[model samples]
Target: MPIDDVSAGHRQELRRGTVALACLLRLRRPDYGYALLEALAADGIDVDANTLYPLLRRLEKQGLVTSEWSTGETRPRKFYRTSDDGERLARDLTQDWYRLDAALRGVIDQGES
Candidate 1:
């Protein structure tokens, strides 16, 4: 792989863990897969459909999220929202992220010297 490809792969590896955290945060208001995809993209997290559908399934299976079908609409959609467990996890992860971000900033500032 080229240098750019290698760096891209490393970037992706760093972001992989953030997906679940982002999903949990975004689902606070309840949304379907497609809407969630757009929301994530708007927020600078680009997640494709194939990846999202399965991640939603896994989150539901893990009890981190709850899903319900809205049949009242002409096109029924399965809406997902963060469960209590998910909310707690999101909160914890957010705190961890903030601490990590501060540490990273310090490291970067020192390296620039």
Candidate 2:
């Protein structure tokens, strides 16, 4: 049976918000859209192009990432890298993620106990 639409939609929205942070965290090295999508999938992010492409554009607009067209390949591709400002934000977000995860785990453990 399929999950209720409301619950699935909510989960998707939550996952959508993390795409930027995940991209910022992963793009320490320059990567093109398809390659970055692969990397994100390999790391279990599971995002679709519909979600990622617009997120990339938005991040670029926000000055959090920089991109350039690479002509070295038969098909030119735009490679993106996190900006210095993005790096700093990623570092702070990483700390926050760790703390939040630990706190949530503690609550789960307390409930279990």
Candidate 3:
């Protein structure tokens, strides 16, 4: 395989876990599927619709999010919002991320020495 292919695969693997965290954070405000997709893209997450829809379904199944269909508009859309469990999870994940960031910083700093 090409070096680029290997690097791309690793990059995607790292991003996979982060997508769930980003979704949990953004869903603090309820949003429809398309809106959520746009919001994630605006935030530089760059998730595709095929990937996003499955992740949303999984999050909902895990009780990290709740969904409802809104019919008051021209077209009914399924809206998702983070649940209490999701908020707690986000907080915990944020703590973990900070710890990992600090550790990486230490490693990088040592390398510079």
Candidate 4:
């Protein structure tokens, strides 16, 4: 395979887990799916609706997120927010992410030495 193809696959793999963490953190402030997508994009996390919607559903199912319909708008939309459990999970995951990042930096520095 070409270098671009190989890099794309690795990038996809690296990003796969970050999406869930990003969603949980972003949804701490209630938002509908499309708006959430925009917000995430603005924050530099690019996630497709196909990927985000299903992740939201799974998070809701797992009790990590709560949702309610807003009917006051011309068009009803379901808004989602991270639950307390989700906040805890996000905290834990963030700490782990930092630790992993530090470890990776150390490995890279060692390799360069």
Model 4 score (lDDT): 0.94
Give stretches of model 4 more than 4 Å off: none
Q: Best candidate, TM-score-wise? A: 3
> How many clashes (backbone N, Cα, C below 3 Å) per candidate?
0, 0, 0, 0
lDDT of 3 at 64: 99
Evaluate candidate 1 by giving its C-alpha RMSD to the native, one decimal.
0.9
Q: What is the model-wide C-alpha lDDT for candidate 2?
A: 0.89
- Kindly report which residue pairs in candidate 3 clash with one another: none
Residue 50 displacement in candidate 2 (angstroms): 0.5
Question: Model 3: which ten-residue window has the lowest total lDDT?
Answer: 11-20
Candidate 4 displacement at residue 52 in angstroms: 0.7
lDDT by residue for model 2 (40-102), tens: 999999899888998989888989999999999999999999999889988888888889889
Per-residue CA lDDT of model 4 for 1-113, tens digit only, reads 99999999899889888999999999889999999998889999978889999999999999999999999998999999999999999999999999999999999999999
**What lDDT does each candidate get?**
0.95, 0.89, 0.94, 0.94
Instruction: Please provide the root mean square deviation of candidate 4 (C-alpha atoms, Å).
Output: 1.0
Per-candidate TM-scores read: 0.95, 0.89, 0.96, 0.95
The superposed Cα distance between candidate 1 and the true structure at residue 19, in angstroms, equals 1.5
What's the candidate order when arranged by decreasing TM-score?
3, 1, 4, 2
Query: By the lDDT metric, which is better: model 1 or model 2?
Result: 1
Model 2 clashes, total count? 0
